[model samples]
Target: MRRTVARRLAAVLATTAVVAAGVAMSITNASAATGGVTGYATQNGGTTGGAGGATVRATTGTQINQALCNRASDSTPIIIQVEGTINHGNTTDVSGSSCDVGSTLIDLKGVSNVTIVGVGAGATFDQIGIHIRESSNIILQNLTVKNVKKSGSPLSNGGDAIGMESGVRNVWADHLTLEASGGEAEGYDGLFDMKNDTKYVTLSYSIMRNSERGGLVGSSETDLTNSFITYHHNLYQNLNSRVPLLRGGTAHVYNNHYVGIVESGINSRAGAKAKVDNNYFEDSKDVLGTFYTDERGTWQTSGNILDNVTWSAQGSENYPAGPSMPSTTTVSIPYSYALDNASCVPSIVAKTAGANKGNQVSDGSCNAQSPSQSPSNPTTSPTTGPTDPGTSPTNPPGGTNLSLGAGADGSSKADGTSYGNVIDGNMSTYWSPSGTTGTVSVKWSSAKTIDTVNIREASGTAGNIDNWQLVNHATGAVLASGTGAGVISFTAVSTTKVSFVITSASGTPRVAEFEVYA
Candidate 1:
């Protein structure tokens, strides 16, 4: 069952709906929150993290674990108020009959009914990761996790600022700041990641910035069990890709502001489905797509403002939803939410999305108020991590230059050029995208067994192709994914056509040869 108060009617619903249900959060000195949990996290039996439980205080990471350890049982409810900075230096493992404590992180392992909220001036987790494994009914709010190193002088959480795996459930994280200075090359992974059957989670009123991979759901194409997550009223800035690379499952993404997205965003691949509604996107490229691979995902877009967003020419592998983006599928949303007018998302989110901003939230009517109002409406989406484009592949398999005399096709051709230039057996001739990047392919009258492709750049434009995917166009299967174009080989498959998709490029790419071999 599915319904849409989004995409199809974003403008109409804004004026029609009254005060939204569950739109509030308050942290007066952060002693504890009096706010209500909204979004999908309220479903699946509800997530009341440490509500009605004994309150405890923790000034360091070890103390936080101690509070968890000292609980009567793993299921005993507890609220731990955190203050000051928590780093690897101040945190140590503590053992208890009811605890699974560890040093590298604030580990919530095999536990349930917990809330860790920041208080006083605020709480910061510096170079430390919050690890949630096999837990249920958890809430994390009013915190900042910054610059966690995966491999350096200090290490924690393998570069993910907050990672949940191993059958976790029912979490609501709000009013937080998760950031890193760089990409994986600088030892930072995802800002938030969920996998291995984690479900029914919500991330609202937060900010994530200055990182490459935003996050991911379901580690691979086969890990499809994770589902029912929401993200709303958040700000994602200066991120490269994976505004969540969701492999499978359903996600609701709305009322967020995204800026400076370099590579891609909201990559819903591997049959995943998302309800992308009422979000503002600016200065980005491929903001919505089923990119890099042929295992396409689906999104239903409504009232989304794509301001100055650049979309590459489409291909079998590089699929973008914008520049005439429409709903590919309808997503069923179980919770009722009040969507603010998309035009006001940027300002509404800026004042209310992160910690220490008085925990203000939307009234679902585009108004911002303190927790003195009711709780906030439920959330929108969880963006995933990206595919690891491997190293330069081996040489093209030994065979005749099958591309010669083949029918040449592409998404678009630049002025004074033709797609047939790529296969004309002349090194001087070339083809380029009508825009900065696009697709070029070779087709046959019938299927051919081929396993290798070599992309040769036209003279003087050698390094423009930064990331690419070789695909079986007939089946939409990614044969190989890698960085830079040379000779890429994969297992042979019989297909009538193959495409070379340039996902990102430093400049206009010129291909003199798109040679294939069998």
Candidate 2:
């Protein structure tokens, strides 16, 4: 007999009635407002569970669960700060025949507007997972979910490192590192799985590595209620398949890096529509489209880079040949985000994506002032930094971020800080010239009209560019000269190259951002 996923999950899962009671109470106490937040907390489930409430600290899984249980019916959002490893209190008794549900774990069933964020080095969930059932407006960030086991244990929600199901909505998981040592046969399931009508979620800057099963949405082809999920800037490394096996939902996937997909990748079936854009896939096989299952899925692909990718031959079992993915539908993204060119994705993602312990995240399209918002709540960090002249502040307007994924040439560069940092839109990271007299330049494939340039001084390297020359390589014209970290405007000039030449400095010259605009 074929073992259906529903049979494996529902057989021992939490009862619908019991979950509904908690949800009902939560809804009753919840604010009439939706998941969106105001002011400082407009990103990531919009102040989920922590808005206008006191923060609670929990050290273990039981304490975390207890804190959530205490606010089971409260509308006032609470923030549960998790510190250290949340392990222990895992039960082995299976409730039913297959899924091994009803286990004593950190179950966030029947909760709303909750934020479980890891502090310091970030929280670790060792051999245990957080189950989000019948919950809404949740944020799980900076947490390392590893070693979620299924051996001799009644794994709730099919042993997912982070499982969401049954009316779950408005969840933002950022900077999480979800990994597993083994696959399902070794008692491990998906790193992250969403099923049974779960919707309106975003997974950004997270890392899913070294696991056989990465994640899946909508358990089976027939189970099509899940929808509206956005995955951006995530790194999927060393996975076998299902970097999401999407089913029956509109998933906007962009700027993700996939490496070492052993068997297949991105099984989109049962009418699921995936918009795959601007992603980098390296050393992966069949990185997109349906696999193993005969049910057909749909995807629209654009701006993707495939390097050293091998495709599985077309057969009855394999859905589509990869390296070039096929899609059945057109998808329009409902938010604003920056897309790094395929060539630049690897470098850009390496510097910007994943958990940067003490660093803030860039807004990769989550917050907007528009009132006519889609049910799918998006998130991005607030835009700050130097604006390119003659261009919009967010981007170079009509111009490109010349430094973006652009090859950097310098007289010399500091170790770990490459010349690319000067234009990656991140001020915290800078490109320090190896010596005080060294120069850094950004060139384009073709000539670009540039009239203004902005230079951000590295925090510790201020006054390094005491005297500098902005040289136009094409014309060998010194366009302008600067002595500080600010805008340097000059006459409009078209050139294929621009260089920041430090003529004098107090210390080693460091440029955080070297932006040009037309």
Candidate 3:
């Protein structure tokens, strides 16, 4: 960032499990909160931000636009709770009717179930940048957004530290720490850009450094319907290229950890279709393909790990993917993700990429784990809550239920209702949805490594499942959300299916038992 000293909010460790050489790691309690909402913002109908809403406590940027102009509409569903530093004179520009905040940094226009998370002693937006337009379900947890400037003196957003354009959709930006301070002749730009038709997005465990642009999905070259995007376990350092420069559609870079990068990375051009997996590029240089122009883009690499990488020579606008990184193309991916072995991804993204560390993760057989929970900070104290998450569970904690025999389905049900009656252990046999909202799932045939879940509601229909969204349907990872539901934890993940939609319901909603654990 521009350095003015204001970055402290990471401390959590009380052991959840650890083994090392033999690999057993599963840790996740460092004041919990983040371990859900993974890649691709968990597909279209996922990204349950601002859970059930109503939970304000801003600390500037005009109380986060007066908490979205005191929401009640504009897709009501709040969750401000920021604390400390939000420059440009504490962010102004208020107006109301459920807001449309402006003045650069922290814009988020046309709101929709918001969530600007980042609590106590943390939440820096210095030099400002956030500017999502025509918004949709959004969630920007544990922030740090840095330096900014498009050409000097506090002129934000256009400088891109988190710019999403017109048709933005589901966005889940976890543990951020975006930076800038040089490039474009030191005026900064693209730290997370997405253009026109931006769709399902997910930039997990973030940490993009030193600036020089490290963002772009579709902002030109036919602006191709900004497609389904997903970049997991991030940690792009020293930047100089669009660690994200895809131009057309479809992207899913997994387990990231690129370093130094310097002139190019990701660059997929016009018809973009990247699928690079199990990443861990080091000492980068032309981190991926298509640079400059000529319009060309397509990738499908696998199990990548280019240590001390550096490959350049091939002009006419340059085109490097690596010393022998072939694959050219072959990308399908509907959903269902799990891959964490590009040689332990640089020690699990340096103890969990960005934000305050602690939200560590891996458990896909590379060890280390920790997720969900987001308030009352401090495995050392800095205050951050949300992982003891909207509360409901009494002893009904973890302890096996893995959806009992596992194998159910949903999106529509009712009549005699049956998605295997909520996984069978009968809480009076339930599962309803034919009206009043939908989605109910559970499946398994391999892949399972959960992290608490328990819906249980029957007898007089305790609360009528009003507001939910805990996904993982293979790889749409969203893990947690709130509003009536006993026990709902999050962090460890390895899925095979696990939906539980329900969006909103105050009546006519029954789900006798949907238990799950790990």
Q: Using TM-score, give the best candidate's number.
A: 1
Q: Where does candidate 2 stray beyond 4 Å?
A: 1-49, 89-103, 153-157, 359-518
lDDT of 2 by residue, 1-518 (tens): 22323232332123222321232100111111111221112222232344334578878766665565555354446677777876666333332221212345566666676777777656787778878888777778778888787674644446688999998877778668898766777788899899998887888767886667889998887889998888876777777778898988888888787766777778888778898887878766788877777777888998787866788678886776465575568976433234445554454345444543332332222211122111122222112222332222332334565657556575567566778887777777777654334567888887778888877775554544455667776655566653555677788988887887653343455678888777
lDDT (tens digit, per residue) of candidate 1 on 375-453: 1212211111112322223454576988997898976777867799889877677888764346789999988899878
Best by lDDT, which number?
1
Residue 478 miss distance in model 3 (angstroms): 17
Model 1 CA lDDT for position 77: 75
Order of quality (lDDT): 1, 3, 2
Off by over 4 Å in 3: 1-47, 51-64, 68-104, 107-128, 131-150, 163-183, 193-212, 216-229, 232-240, 245-262, 267-421, 429-510, 513-518
lDDT of 1 at 202: 92
Alpha-carbon local distance difference test for all models: 0.77, 0.64, 0.73
Candidate 2, residue 34: the lDDT equals 16
When sorted by TM-score, best at the front, the candidate numbers are 1, 2, 3
Q: After superposition, how far is residue 139 of candidate 1 from its true place, in Å?
A: 0.2
* 10 residues in a row with least lDDT, candidate 3: 8-17
Query: Of models 2 and 3, which has the larger lDDT?
Result: 3
